[model samples]
Target chain A: MLGALKRLWHKLGSPRWFFALTSFWVSLFGWAALLFLLVGVVWGLAFAPADYQQGNSFRIMYVHVPAAMLAQSLYIGMGVAGFIGLVWRMKLTDVFIAASLPLGMAVTALALFSGSVWGRPTWGSWWEWDGRTVSTLVLFFLYVGIYALREAIAEMQLRARASALLAMVGTVNIPIIKYSVEWWNTLHQPASFGLTQKPAMPSEMWLPLLVMVLGFYALAGCVVLTRMRAEILHREGSARWVGEWVAGRRGS
Target chain B: MYFDSFTEFLQMGKHGLYVWLAYGSTALVLLWTWLSAQQSLASVTRRVEQQAQLAARNTQLAARNTMSGGAATGSEREQNLAGYDESET
Candidate 1:
């Protein structure tokens, strides 16, 4: 099984094959994203019961939780891709890193923004130096740092290698960000929702949140796949298959 | 449906501004990201197509130049040199 998975991974390293393989998954998740996000947001905003303690402000959870979760998960993804790129020397892994950086940064920024917004109504303040918030802020900057590293280098391969290295080094912070809330006293509540165990919130509330989380992941995947496709085409522009692919697009 | 009326729904009890602002900003950012990704892909496609066409044209021109020596027909040279512009990459 391990050997088979390795073979599949190597096969997927080919730019043309990767592009073709991801096309169907991209479209599938694209539609699923639309369906799940629409349903989840509408349901959470309207149908779910409001929080007894925090009232309607808790509605922010539908977006905040998912964005925060995706922020960390995407960072971890970048780290893993970086390791693969550095170790296996997979060019596809570099493409994955480039494609994910912008999306990850956007989601992280959104998480911070939503968290701050949620803070105002509930905590009566807009900002705090709590461990969770500060660590996440650092995570956001780490993403920015990687992006800046990419732009500062002129050569493509060098830029990718440098950024990939930075991504790997930054993996150390993910755990700190994840555990900050529990390790320190903060106004931010613990995760009330979990997939592996019983949820702290009632079914109706956590259910929509669960949908929103899945929707966010699906949406993130679609965006990354779209960007990765473009990166693959650009990098493999000299390949005959790419020329044919471009010609096909022109015909379509 | 949880609320009594549309106004209350829009208001979101007392936290409407916070709720709407959070959702609105996130939606706007995500939409912009998606649109820009599509635009980036389109731009890359356009660039790749242009480069491929230019390369093919250059190859064709080079071949034609080699086929015809310095002593060439007026019409052929004129045709060959007519508005011929290409970036040497």
Candidate 2:
């Protein structure tokens, strides 16, 4: 099993293979995001019914839910990259870690800020010291620290190893952030938007939420793909392929 | 189907500000990420090509100078110098 897994990793981890995969993902996600965003925004904003409880305030769920989900996914992704880079010593894995940092940070910041925005009207306060909120805030800071640490280092290998260590340590907070609401008596409500739990709100509410979620994932992919390609060029700048590709682009 | 009109639905009982802003920011962030990535790629490529071209130029110039100057004759010079030594049998 381990041998097969190793073979698969080696095959997939190659630059050409990885680049091909990213290209497919970027194209698919880009188109999917556009389609979903259009349908979601048009249907949701224009056709969905307003919530009885929160009135118009509930509409914020469209953006709020997706951002929050992406935030969680991004942290896990960073941790995964860090693990792969540290374990396999794949330069591409390190590239992924470096590239993923900004995207993860962006998502984290969006989640934290949007949650604050939503909390203002719903909870009647702009800030809360609840477990979930605090943990998520820490998650954002983790991303920031990784970002800064990567830039602070001069050597690429040293930077990758160092950031991977930080990423491993910080990943411990992810589950803590997710379960904080359940584990502690927090002011924030439990998960409203997930696979298992049905949305407490109406279909009109959830349909748009679904659209937004799909759109957000697509958008995240596009962002990641773009960054990954750039990272490829940066790391492999001296490589024959990168030189040829960049020359083609410049010539065109 | 449930909505009377699409425009009316989007209004969300006048909570459009928050919804639109949220959505807008998502779009913005995605764009920013893509553009930034492209920018870095361009710079990296440029730097690498510059270094490669410089190295190639240096190697070519060195080769030309060596060819024009001819090969080193250190061994031949040493043999000649040995023969001239007065004490050598």
Candidate 3:
């Protein structure tokens, strides 16, 4: 089994294969995200009934929840990439981690901003210092630090190593951000709209949320894939074939 | 099925601005981020190619300079040899 697994890993680890395979997956996820998002937005915004207490304002959940979920997952992903980059000295892994930064920041910002917006309507305030909110805020800062750290270093290899280290260190916030509500008596609601358990909502409420979640995932995937491809091109520019490939692509 | 009329939906039962702003800003910012990345990638790619082109051109120029110097050296030697021959005669 280990041998078989090693063979599979070797095949998948090829840059050519990874690029080709990622294109396929990105397209699939991109389209699926689009379809799911469309259904989610229309259903959540137009079709679903308003909440008894929150009214139409509750529809913001479709955006807020998805962004929050994406933000959480993207950070974990970057951390994993950082680990791979540090362990294997894989250029692609570092590139992937770097490429993911902007998207992750966007999602984190969206989650925080939307949460603030949602807060004002529901809690009569636009900001809170609760554990959940505060920890997620720190996650956003960690992302910024990684981006800034990478940009500050002049040497590319050193930059990647340093930023990856920072990312690996910052990953402790993921679990804390996730369980902040359960860990403390925060104002934020506990996880009811989870993936595994049944959502504490009617079909109308849950279905749109599902769509939005998938859509957000699609958007993130598309963004990151594009970034990764560009990073590959940038890094490969010195290769003999890269110049010809660039010329061909440019001509086309 | 949700709202009785457009007014109620717009009203958001009193949270219209907050709700719309939150969702709208999220969507807009996402669009901006994607567009900006594409721009950055384009610029970076262009810069790398330009640097490569500049390096190749510099090598060509250096070769030309070296060739010119060699020919000039030969010309100076010939000129000096011609003066010596004339003076000896």
Candidate 4:
């Protein structure tokens, strides 16, 4: 098993292998995302029970919670990819970091936007300086910062190194973002989902939410894989395999 | 199904605006993310195709020049060299 795992790890380091392995994943995740999002949205919006206190404003949770969760999760994924790149000096990991940054930034922006929109009706404010909100904002900045840092460095090796270092270092804020609500008295409520405990909401409400979360993950997968493929092509354009791939694409 | 009628569902217990806004913007963002990635992929694919074509052209030019005992025109050689430099970047 260890030998197999090591072999897989080595295979993953090759951009051509990664690209070929994930070609089908892009379409698979795209279809899954569409199906899951459709079901989850319809269920959450029209079928799920409304909150007694918040009424249908609670429907916003379907989009808000998933985006918020995915935003943080993507950042953490980037940090891990960055660590792998820095440690293994794997080219694929750097490509992953580059590919994921824009998606992560977009998702974080969506999370903040959706949250504030949800906030207006529920909290009677469009914006707040609370701990959870501020920390999440900082997370958004971290994505932007790393992206800019990568672009500003023209030397490819230096660019990857700098962005990887920044991504790994920025992971410190993730814990703070996770625990900010508990650590400080804040307007933001505690997390809705947890692994070890039952959800505070009933099954009827959380089930659609579960679907939406999965849908968001599928969407992320679709986007990241597509972007990664593009990054791989761009970085490995000189490779003989890349030329063959381009020829094949043209023939097809 | 939760509401009595279509109108009531659209009204969304008078919180329709916020709920729809949130969902609408989320949809837009998600759409943009997917579309932009597709765009990036298409753009990169085009670039790689162009690079491949240029490389092939350069290789053909080099081979022809070599077969001709380096009798290729200086201007033609310079153009081929320039293409090679462009493809290198």
Candidate 1 is scored at a TM of 0.93
lDDT of 1 by residue, A142-246 (tens): 999999998899898898789889999999999888788799887778878766889987899998998999999999988999999999988888789987887
TM-score per candidate, in order?
0.93, 0.80, 0.83, 0.94
Candidate 4 structure quality by residue, lDDT tens digits, A147-197 = 889878999999999998999999999999999999999999897778899
Span of 10 residues, lowest total lDDT, candidate 1 chain A: A186-195
* Model 3 alpha-carbon drift over 4 Å, by segment: A1-17, A20-27, A250-252, B45-89
Off by over 4 Å in 2: A1-7, A246-252, B1-17, B45-89
Please state the Cα-based DockQ of model 2 relative to the true two-chain complex.
Answer: 0.28
Q: List the residue pairs that clash in candidate 4.
A: none
What's the count of clashing pairs in each model shown? 0, 4, 0, 0
Span of 10 residues, lowest total lDDT, candidate 2 chain A: A241-250
- Model 4 alpha-carbon miss at residue A187, Å: 1.6
Can you give the lDDT of residue A126 in candidate 4? 98
Considering TM-score, which of the candidate structures 2 and 4 is the better prediction for this target? 4
User: Which wins on DockQ, candidate 2 or candidate 3?
Assistant: 3
Model 3 C-alpha lDDT per residue in residues A1-252, reported as the tens digit of each score: 999998877765555555546767667766776688778877877789888888877889989999999988988888888898899776677888888899899889989999999998788889989999999999999999999998899899899889888888999999998889989988998876865888887987888888788888888887788778677767665666556655666689
